[model samples]
Target: MSTFGDLFRVHTYGESHCKSVGCIIDGCPPGLKLTEEDIQVQLSRRRPGQSDLTTARSEFDTVHLQSGTEHNVTLGTPIGLLVHNKDQRPHDYAETDLYPRPSHADYTYLAKYGIKASSGGGRASARETIGRVAAGAIAEKYLKEAAGVEIVAFVASVGKVELPFAQGEDEVLGKEFVELLRTTTREQVDKELTRCPHRETSDKIADAIRSAKSREDSLGGTIICVIRNCPLGLGEPAFDKLEAVLAHAMLSIPSTKAFEIGSGFRGTQFLGSQHNDPFVDGVDARTGQKRLRTSTNWSGGSQGGISNGEDVYFRVGFKPPATISQQQNTAKYDGSTGVLETKGRHDPCVLPRAIPIVETMAALVIMDMFLKQNARSSAASLLEPVDHLPPSMILPGKNKVVETQLVEDKVVQE
Candidate 1:
């Protein structure tokens, strides 16, 4: 379960308080323009101490490419990415060894392995997500260049405060919102420390998080992520549906408690006649071709477990961070009652930091599924004479996609 994906697989390693943390990404296509700079954009967003809303711990979090690329280009081999731990304070978590924090992974991990790392909840800490964010940035870059795919995630809610645009029904992701959601820049989200796009709600969320930090308590919230311009037919049937895989990715984030895709649970309030997406046929505005679209996207761009060329959107509910620095009644490993006061640098509201993590994870899912779908749909192009090639493979003066196949004109006479 630690490893993910079929084509663009990434295996992460290291613990929270370890000397370093990193991931090895296999199956990345050759000839991609990859560098530490490409990966750092997302890492910087996920970094701790970006603002007062997140944890104050600082590691610089500078990534160093260990392998799989030369001259800043991918080799189609395994890419090794690492970020060394610089400011780990294991002594701060020494007491956690004697008593497992309530609602934290200490007890479950110990039960599974009969032993656990004693510092910063080991691999269970949000620090473990650093590697995930790095790998995701790579996936996102490849997807963007290959298919013009765009991934965006924003803090939808902090406690009871929610962004007006992303709130309401989960299935409300539509053409109207795609443009609006796409308008939400990282700069706008960063304007307020809460990372909620709405200015008013962002302030409320910030105040709530600060209040929790003051009380030594924690707050939980939700994030809404969207995948734009995803190609059609990327998903497996039955168990591996696109929506199902998306749910799997979101729920995998630390402290995530629930997952919903398009219309989600709220759609149940409507009848079948109201919830169904009616097909609308039209001419393409860009390609000048015929196109079929759903008038409404209650299916969230997925139907029968596969994408239908619409924007895929969903929401993930994150629970309160389990590592609150407050005294609570809890049991020790010896099965005795004790007052446990967890200590360490932790985020009061995990939703803000979870945004980049969510974006990267979504990129991983889309990148993997797109590769799988491309294999099946690229057959007609094979063995055909190429008029144009990918920018990396094309000669000078060729940048557009070549669709005009070579045709032989020979007249036969009897």
Candidate 2:
């Protein structure tokens, strides 16, 4: 579905070089503070031309809040957000119309629709993500104001140049790592071109990108995102686990090839004894109720598809941009093999541009689950005590986590 989320739905529309790209947000609460300015912060980060590491094309990407809010407040209507495409060079991609770019959506999109946008991979372009970033900015604002949740993403790897979170010979996630997660922000991440907080490693990643650019090629990397203050029991378990939805959202990004949620692949190496998130008794500040706490986060803040009140962290692997200037042998529509050289403004590495997209997609999934869980608890409360339920949904503008301390509370009270 072009739409994401059951309760907090966002239906994105338009294409890469279309006159405009936008989305319709359905089901946001009434009276929430929202404005075009709120959405622009993320669009700016996602926009190209911020530096030489990304594509050379630059557009103002100014957003027009068409409908859904008045006087800077949401009326609980379908929010309409739009961004005009001002600098589109369709001729640059005319070659793609005849011969599909290797490892790109050009072939598949044509196969599925019998026709495709002759320019820019159409919806497949990273430009299509403009609508997503816009919608996600609103989702993020709602999340922060409602639940005190903060999400941050940074470059974890650039073509095998890894950082601390992806370090080798490690204790996995230790006390020091958790401490670092608390203070990480978009600003700190932006301090470096690679968006990696580590100066030395970021330089290496930048160098790799420059080398690829020099070769008329591209490189791939991974991004690590962390969610702080996630409410307990926010996921719809079994089929729609929190991790599953998150993976779904992240993989939707262009060039995203792999996804890993806490503990990740390395956890496979650990014995059951080493991998478990052992719990302890702790009190909830809001409700004054005793709750369960985990000493470690090998579980990645989730169990059985439900959030367990730990920081939710994950990694996303992105492949290099498929459209490159180098010559390649590929078949045309009739299966005749021929050499092709692609054109257009392309990034040597997509990881830097992908950082904000990862953050936004994560927020979209989190906000979706947050609303879904709230609806469930609110419904179940008609016959049961909500105090022992997972957690109440944070009302819009509340800015405080609802009094929710469950699991242990259910055991003790029962």
Candidate 3:
């Protein structure tokens, strides 16, 4: 389903090579400050053709807000935003309409619908994600204001070249590591072929892509995302857990192959004693308040499908992009096996463009949860309190009075 969320809903539409792509946000609270500029900031980050390592198609990716706001604040009405497609070369894929691009959804789409968009991947195109990113920008703003939450993601690995982990621990990488990565120049990496920041490693990766391209093949890599300062009690239980929601959102991206959180599959190697998060009460070094904490975070800030108030972090793996410029074995429309060489403007690696998409998806998931929790809490507070005096002051439901009293007390305490 295109629509997602229980309290804050978002529906994305449009396809690659279409006139435009956009989203409609149905449940954003009124009075939140938002505008086309806020959405454009993120859209530019995900736009293709920004650098040498990404695709060659260039798009201005400017956002146009259609409705649901007055002046600059949301009006508690459905918000609509659109980004027009400025550059499209549909003719590139006209010849290959009957030949599905290897590793893409082309075959599956044809198998299901019997007809597919001849240009680009159509609805399956990464272009459709523009709407998601636009809607996510607003979601991120609300989440930050409501919960003080922040999320950051980057290219953790490209091919075999992975970021160096400090002290070989699974804890969150600090600012020093971020600075180290930030200092590495794109020119230095792009100077070689592999897009690796390291000169030596990049050369190797570049050669591989060149060779793969010649052979009609592609490559894929992993991205690491870190979420910080997320409030406790954001996620739900069971099927709607934070991790599950994040995974579902992430896997929806094109070419995603795997998902991992916290220590992820690697934690399985450790015994329960080693993998357990130990709870402890300690004074906060930053806030000076006594707080409950865990010495280690193997659960990735979630336990029992709920947020544990720690950093919510995860990794997603993407396969090599389809549409390699080389000859490949495939079936023809007549049902006979044949060879074909695909031609189109494609990226050697989707990592650079994908980084923003990962962050955008995370923002959407977290923002939706934030809105749901806030709405439930607000609704619960509006209910009238009940009092009884016969023998004992008993409400119809257990803890009903206590819950009402707690809400009242909290207001007074605030």
Candidate 4:
């Protein structure tokens, strides 16, 4: 249950107050360049104490590569990584001993395991995502080298503050929003402490976070991620669709409340005629030949549960961090009533630090799907072409997936 992925497996371990928190990556392709610093970059982004809006907990989150490398080259074996929890203060969570801490995992974890960690939230803490972020950095390196895939995520909103252009006319498919998805980089996102690329919106989000922090409360918002240059056909049909797996991966993040791809909930209001992504003729950069691409990307680069070689985008909604410093009247483990106030450093708004975590999780999902599709395509390539099927069913020539679409269109016209 602690592990994820099929071809690129990752198993995470440790807890918030544990001695260390890290992961073991199994099935990493061999002979790729890797180092502690490569992984450390993303870890530092996710670490607390980066700004006043985030948790005050001071953690360097320095990563150590324990195994599975030879002189910076992966040995095609399970990679082991570790990051010591140097600044842990277990005594800060002593309040959880009596009360369950409403909206926190204290009560349910005890009900399920019959006992819970005496300090911190244990596996439920955002600290658990450290291992995921580390493993994702490795997968992301391989994907970029092997497929030229680029994944980027940014804080799209904080409470009521959002980028005005994103919600402009024509919905998310507007020219400006599309260009933003296509061009915004991690550096641009990191320009603000809120991780929002829009300067004015970022300032507003920061102020809202400070307001909540001053009140000893927390706020929640959304994150938008884009994956470009994804290979076609990277999902399993009938189940585990590309979007489905993406939803699973995103919802697993602590406090994440919702996941939606492409047009998301906004597209629901559009009729099929308005929402459909019409196929258009385009030139492939690699081959200098005509290719089929969607005129609009409302499908988020996936169609019929498979990638369509277009930019994939999605939004994830995170709930307010459950552990706030404010006092609350709640029930204890024994069902008794009491006033419980949480201790320890906590974030008023997690959107900023959560940026890298979101990008890494997306990288992990894409890496797994890419490997699965690669195997399927490799095996299919060895088979002789089948010519008996109708033109609508059989692609006209090697990689002429558009021919099948044209034939289907003719049938509909008839």
- The top-ranked prediction according to lDDT is 4
Candidates sorted by lDDT, best first: 4, 2, 1, 3
- Cα RMSD (Å) per model? 7.2, 5.0, 5.7, 4.9
Candidate 1 error regions (>4 Å): 165-182, 283-289, 380-414
TM-score of every candidate: 0.88, 0.91, 0.84, 0.94
Give per-residue CA lDDT, model 1, range 249-315, as digits (tens).
8888889999988768766777788789898985433234456778777777899998877778888
Model 3, residue 385: C-alpha shift (Å)? 9.4
Question: Which of candidates 1 and 3 reaches a greater lDDT?
Answer: 1
Off by over 4 Å in 2: 165-170, 173-179, 283-290, 384-414
**Residue-wise lDDT of candidate 2 within 1-414, one digit each (tens)?**
678888889999888888999899998888899888999999988888988898998788899999989999999999999999999898898777568889989899999999899898888888889888999999999988877778999998899787765345546654545565667788889999889887888999999899889999899999989998787887876889999999999999989999999879978876788778888877544345556778788888988988988889998999988888999999887888998888789888888878889988999999888877666554444453333333345422222344233322332233
Residue-pair clashes, model 2: 0
lDDT for predicted candidate 4 compared with the true structure: 0.86
What are the per-residue Cα lDDT tens digits for candidate 4 across 1-414? 899999999999999999999999998999899999999999999999999999999999999999999999999999999999999999999988888888888888998999988888999999999999999999899888877788999898899988663455446456666777889999999888899997888889999999999999999999999998777677888789999999999999999999999989888877888889898888543334467888888999999888888888999999999999888988877788889889889999889999999999999998998777666555555566565566666443454222222122212221
Return the lDDT, model 2, position 348. Answer: 87
- C-alpha displacement of 407 in model 2, angstroms? 15
lDDT of each: 0.80, 0.83, 0.73, 0.86
Clashes of each: 2, 0, 4, 0
TM-score, cand. 1:
0.88
**Residue 222 accuracy (lDDT) in model 4:** 97
Candidate 4 stretches greater than 4 Å from native: 165-173, 285-289, 399-414
Q: What stretches of model 3 exceed 4 Å from their correct place?
A: 165-217, 282-289, 382-414
Model 4 residue 282 lDDT score = 86
